[model samples]
Target: MNDLTKIMVSKGGTPADITVGDALEYRAALQEHHAQSAGHTLFYAWLRRLGSLPDDAPATLRNPSRATGQVGIEQLVDRCDLTCRPVRDLMVDYLTERRPGLDYPNAGQRPRSLS
Candidate 1:
């Protein structure tokens, strides 16, 4: 909300004055500055509910990079730089088998542990 407030103030308006363009610009700024997904925020929904934004406005102000493909098990294993081909292949197979049971955070941690 602070970010929105700043934008609104800079534009010489209130929250009710925020537009879809403003929200999109904010999302882009977040992605460019933070170098990661902006995820979802309630401001868009709030603006829509207040009739400040169109009902057809997006539910999220997330970055398009949020839809990027997940890194593959092979890619994750390769980053570990295992010198032995057998060990590298085995680690990949292990991760592949375990991936179904693991959530994203746990799956991400597995590669770091390998290093």
Candidate 2:
């Protein structure tokens, strides 16, 4: 990232002063605040519109869109594989339920086959 300067501007007879550290923090805080406010606003608005969705509604349907209400999770899974993650979870599970004699790191490494 490039270095940004904090400018002290004279706006409408008022002098605004900010330091370098203040500018970076202000930018990040502003972005995070926007994201949180948007999430809260959208959640309440959608909840007010649609009382409560049934269990059959897919995960993708969590967000309300302009198209249709019947779009389910199967379509989402078909369009995009949401489970394409690293083998960290499988490694954790294996480590949790490992036998003492088995050499997990050097020898047999049994994991959930995603591919």
Query: Using lDDT as the measure, which candidate wins?
Result: 1
Tens-digit lDDT string for candidate 1 (1-115): 7676867876768888888888777767767888453433566767877888766566556542343446678877888889999999988888787776564545435533433
What is candidate 2's lDDT per residue for 1-115, written digit by digit as tens? 1111212231122112322233334345546777432332232223234534334333332333423453433443344544644444454455445533343344555643333
TM-score for each candidate, following the candidate numbering: 0.46, 0.17
Worst 10 residues of 1 by lDDT: 106-115
Cα-based lDDT for every prediction: 0.69, 0.36
Question: What is residue 1's positional error in candidate 1, in angstroms?
Answer: 2.5
Model 1: residue 87 alpha-carbon error in angstroms: 40
User: What lDDT would candidate 1 get against the real structure?
Assistant: 0.69
Error of 1 at 84 (Å): 35
Q: Which residue pairs in candidate 1 collide?
A: none
